[model samples]
Target: NAGIAATMPALDYPLAHWQLTMAVNVTAPFLIAQHTLRAMRRKQWGRIVNVASISGVRAGTGRLGYGTSKAALIALTRQFAIEAAEWGVTVNAIAPGPVDTPLIRGMHGGSTAGTYASMLPMRRYGTTAEIAHAVSFLASEQAGYITGHSLAVDGGFLASGLLVRDLFEPAASAPS
Candidate 1:
């Protein structure tokens, strides 16, 4: 389940907003895993991938609730992975940056979307297919050795820590 950020200052977070975001982003995943793991344990094979967000790894402008909830989800993924490994179940999270999903487009329209893209090291928003590929890999038999990992499919957004334009823009001429 996707989460909705209240986009407010930490101190301004409404109780309802925090509750709702946690309900969808964190609690839902925990509940799903609780039920699903039973069958996975029985079969001795399973893969569960939670869709977290870059906000979970790093704070943004104003995502107190959203970020917190996603962070919780990541922790949950790790905890489940450790326990489920012996049963042949893998639990991991894919933290996507700015994917070109309808939800993202709606959240960041027109120029705002472009601005967000420029901030990424790739200077472009990630495609849903890219995120899916990561999920597909983690779910495959080849990834059996991997568990309790949060794979970021963010086009280097998490690594760069600086904008593409700032990294590549031509230097201004110094006074002669």
Candidate 2:
């Protein structure tokens, strides 16, 4: 699910925004999976790939509702995966980092790009195709053995903890 990112501090976040975010990001997927799982169970083969986000995996400012909802989505994926596994169905989630989508473009300011570049190991926003390829793989028969996994399509964002530029710079020569 490409859920809405209503950027705001938790204190300033409105109840309606929270409810709407949860409905679209969590509830909709739940209902869709619930409805389709039965038919897939009957068929004894199926693949369900839910679109989650890196925000779910990692906390970010101004993402209280969006992050929480995607986090729920990730959990839901696991729940469905465990039950569906026996029936030859695999349920998985793709947690993509900042992708260059219209939604993201709209949300990000001019400076946001530079900030993201500094933070992300790849030093650039991910492409929609990159995210799609990951999803495609998970849905393919090749990924039959994989289930209940939230594969992060981020370009080392999750792995690059404590990314300080100063740390990477050369140390000054010791005084004689």
Candidate 3:
């Protein structure tokens, strides 16, 4: 989903922006699956991959519409997975973190880029190819057993917490 950022306080957030974002990020997936599922069901095999976002799992400072919409996409992936699994269809989602894409560059250019890097344990943004690799793996025959999973290609950002204690630790206490 190519979502537009409408960052604002809840009271100030535009309803149009929220609706538009949800339409693209959430509703489109449902529509696509609705149209495509019948063919896959006939074939008895299908791969439905939804590209969600970390914002969906963890709400950010000013991403009400984008986050909420992506959360819905993730939920949709699960619902579709349950209903489609018997037909040999695997529905999954990829929740990408800060990636070195035009979108990220546009959103976090200049010194602000470092702020996003610091939040992740990897201390860097992910690459588009890395995300593609994950998707490729999920789509592969070897991944047939995997379904309804939201894979985080986020360089550990989603699983990690702030390292406040690490900052105050002596050099010796730091992991090598």
Candidate 4:
């Protein structure tokens, strides 16, 4: 939760915050590794993929705490990856951008989400299936060589350097 803590201070207040974030984002993986390693040792292979966020990578506008926790989750994925390697287990992270999930669209709306798409080079928010594919790939046998890596399902949003601050500035001071 490095960078996110600064952005979403409110996230730190919820009674369920720690449990909510740590469950699937942290302890779930830890327990999975604890249980899966035995099978990995038996079969001599295993794959573990953590669903991270673009927020985990470049940081987001108001997602400070949420994003920071996600960033920590990414590091956790890597740490577990390194430790699990000797047991033939590979761990990876998938960083998704703004997806057309109810969580996002509900937070704003379809129109708002679409507006974000207009800002992105791809001109569309990603679908859940897109992120799922990356997870599936990482979980597949083909991803054996990959570990401690984060794949961006961002539709090029993470690549562009269009600072949002510029978009908010006056017309005369705009980047364009």
User: What is the number of backbone collisions in each predicted candidate, taken in the order shown?
Assistant: 0, 1, 0, 8
**Backbone clashes in model 2, listed as residue pairs:** 1-51
Higher-scoring candidate on lDDT, 1 or 2: 2
What are the per-residue Cα lDDT tens digits for candidate 3 across 69-176? Answer: 989989999999999999999999999888898877886768667866886789999999999998898888888988999998889977895332333344476566
Model 2 spans with C-alpha error above 4 angstroms: 162-176
TM-score of each: 0.89, 0.89, 0.88, 0.79
> How does each model score on lDDT?
0.86, 0.87, 0.83, 0.73
Off by over 4 Å in 4: 1-20, 162-176
CA RMSD of all predictions:
4.2, 4.7, 5.4, 4.3
Q: What's the distance in Å from true for residue 89, model 3?
A: 0.6
| Candidate 4 residue lDDT tens string, 35-77 | 8778887887888777777877885555655666788778988
Using lDDT as the measure, the top candidate is 2
Candidate 2: 10-residue stretch with minimal lDDT: 161-170
Q: lDDT of candidate 1 vs native?
A: 0.86
Better of 2 and 3 by TM-score: 2
Displacement of the residue 140 alpha carbon in candidate 2, Å: 0.5
- By TM-score rank, best first, the candidates go 2, 1, 3, 4
Better of 2 and 3 by lDDT: 2
Better of 3 and 4 by lDDT: 3
TM-score for model 1? 0.89
How close to the true structure is residue 21 of candidate 3, measured as C-alpha lDDT? 86
